[model samples]
Target chain A: MAKNKRDGTFYINPYLGGVLLGLVLFGTYYITGRGLGASGAVKSSVVSAVHTIAPVHAEGNKYYSKFLSDDASPMSNWLVFEVIGVIVGGFLSGTLYGRLKFIVEHSPKITGRTRLIAALAGGILFGVGSQFARGCTSGAALSGMAVLSASGIITMMAIFGSAYLFSWIFKKLWI
Target chain B: MVGPLIPMGVIPETWNNVIALLLGVGFGFSLEASGFSSSRKIMGTFFGYDFVVLRVFFTAAITAMTGIFYFDYMGWMDASMLYINPYYVMSAIIGGIIMGFGFALGGFCPGTSFTGVAIGKIDAMFFSGGLFIGVFIFSELYPLFQGLYNSHNLGGAKIYELLGMRDTVFAFLLIVVAVGMFYGAAFVEKKVTKVEY
Candidate 1:
């Protein structure tokens, strides 16, 4: 039904989708001994790019140095590969759902430019936050919750709690 | 192989990236198929228009947690061997707060943003680009935040242990909480005016 009736809300049942995602996560742990991640991939990319452009600076920095190692290129990391797969998978799904299109999704009240600026700002914040938390929603929050990690639960609460409060403050962004 | 095939040497290390790719496919498919490609849909969880994010997130967490428990109980795998991110008190909280702020502004987390980009959303591309800039800024300013970043490291601490409760008990409570939230979300969704995304 979700596939047939095509509109903006074209999607599978939320509960079913959740189960499928959970299974993938579970399989990831069973096979890899760790949870899925998103921000880590981006972090790695930043590190690798910086290292390539300004080798000495990347090495000198405490944070970038932490991720850089002698044995492998930062780009040759697990998260990087996983992220590439994520892109491929998403493309496949988009094609199947006939949802692939180049458009800016924005509130009717706001122009596309405003939406993009907000998105860029949001990305920057998320990027910084991911570094601080050592993960993002998927890595620290969801995956962490699955394993019952203390930091995971605390971080999860902080993210959702803060987001709930902030969403009210920025209600115009959505509604 | 008991589990965590790569780490346990049941599977060779070379297959690490290969496995990561395969699993990522599943992960991406799940998120996109669930409508995570739309930032509006994700924002709906907070605005109360659609509870898809809440429903899917809690359900997935519960399902995986339950699977881990059952597998460990049956001795099919060792849960302890699984890598848990070290619990850094100050940084984790601060990072989450900052990220939450971003979520409201950006309407997409890093994972979901990638899914958005996958579906050819121009906004998602900008968001992803911003992610790079943010990471660069943090890396450049790492010195100022170094003290806060490395401060309070509780390595791989489990929540149940910290709460001084049995694992099973804590897990049961979490499941109850998730189920309760699902009902609450459904109730809230009914009251809120639906927005066409």
Candidate 2:
């Protein structure tokens, strides 16, 4: 493996990384009959939290009730387990690359508070959109693209297209 | 002999979780190694300073699509059984636009944020924390959005079918487009000013 000038900055080629990701995605479908997902786990977590706080409320809500069942906990969902794997996988990558370090990352022009605020707002929009679209960027856009799903392609275009437009609007936040 | 191992029974249900873990590992590794752990690098796709996201994303999409199609042709997997995402046009477009807003503002999406969190990025942690809150909000307000959410349900619709073309033809065209974008990205990368994270 080639090393970068800075420690823990080494990375594989983008094309190679893409091929590897493709295989992982292919493997996922082959074994689980599904593609990869990240946000769905977060949704599960949210559902579980609501269920714990107000079982009645959770059951009353059509969306929450749909996911709620006596046979298994919401936390025991496939996406939940997969997310756990993501954490472990990410940890392993960080450990191997020696990149594990606790810190806040932001543009030089912005304060940590500003970044955090943006992050929170972004999460909220993403959360709402994922529900509306039936998945997040990973679950909807990427996975959808793999299977040539119209929703996936449209969602992918919308997200990236909107981001490109908004990025210019919020250029100060990043650049 | 193509697609969706579950319907064909080529892959047992029992091993699903284990496979998830292994795939997750690869997913994480590729993401982190591609510098996705850094917010600036990811944001660079919009700035034109770096096209890593564009390069990696389209490459992965085309690669997987082609691989699956090829395997189907080789009599390896049953493509007919493969699961395609259901199309809900209005919901998809609206949801995507909203999610894009989040991407530009949040500097991290669910998947990349996990990679960042793995590297001990506090911002990533907060972004994920926000996801929990956001999802909670959605679930709580489900009644208000239920109509839109379930408004349109096209079951596992394929893009090619909708476009009035064969799947192979669409896939082939996509490959050409992706290759063109790859070259375009390289050219843009060279022209844009480099931003240090």
Candidate 3:
């Protein structure tokens, strides 16, 4: 099992990685009755930040108030903790593969600035879209599909289908 | 005892966050180890240069679905107890289309962006920041989008039921389709010229 290639970096085979990921997702459902998530944590952080900066305003808002509680901080949620674990796990993997470098990855044709701007724009769109759809790729799509949920399957197709269509429009950014 | 330990009370509520942390670690490790930390690598799926995203994604979906079926069949878990995102016809499709546009432009999704941040990718940091701003925007403008967001709710509908098929039958067909796509992806990858980031 060649761990490292000649370039001082290594990656697991995709299929094997998929199996491991599948088992992890299965464990999540077995134990927590919920699927994995990433954007939810960011939503939590946003709620917490708003609560801290404007307690009254946050409490008054419809969305923020839905997550607010008298006994617990908004940040003290399961998704937040899971995201922290994601960071730790990612760091560990990076260390193992010798890829823990501070660099901006982009296509050679695009400037780092261009990539950053696009990334930011994309993130904003994803954040808004996730809220509307009730979950992102991990939460609504992957998790939903695991249980054969209609919304999950539909959302998954929409995301992939739209991406395939838009990728051509944004071809200059990648290829 | 039926599985989904938390709901079944097999695992106490206090351990929920702890379990979450452990599961997240596995999720994160698998993603980063499979080159998901690189946005370009992920975008490869869209361009047909690399099919890793499709391969890993479909494989994991099938594996988890299969596990759920097996567990339920063996009486180890109650499939009915699992949480399902409710179906909102318009919102789901509209939101997904927007996300797809974002994905191509940003080259990273929420989960993958976190992996990028962990590996110290500056673009990922900006992308995460963008997420916070986007959420804030949505929260502030909730009233304007409230109707669209709340309309056409189907309430946790299952795909098999919607299609008037058995769960086992649906699962079997999904697996067959996934395997066929896997082969097709391999063929496409061979034809497309590899693009290095």
Share of true Cα-Cα contacts across chains kept by each model: 0.88, 0.75, 0.83
Which candidate number has the best TM-score? 1
Docking class of predicted structure 1: high
Give one digit per residue, the lDDT tens place, for model 1 in A100-122. 89999998878899999999999
What is the clash count for each candidate, in the order shown?
0, 7, 0
The residue pairs found clashing in candidate 2 are B1-B77, B2-B77, B2-B78, B2-B79, B3-B77, B3-B78, B3-B79
Off by over 4 Å in 1: A1-8, A70-76
| lDDT by residue for model 2 (A1-175), tens | 4354237777668898788777878777665556788888887778788889898988898888887773273224777777777777778878777788998888989999999888888878888888888888778888889889898899999999999999999999999
Model 3 TM-score (2 dp):
0.96
TM-score of predicted chain B versus true chain B for each candidate: 0.98, 0.95, 0.98
Interface RMSD of each: 0.9, 1.4, 1.0
TM per model?
Answer: 0.97, 0.95, 0.96
> Model 2: residues >4 Å from true position, as ranges?
A1-6, A70-76, B1-3
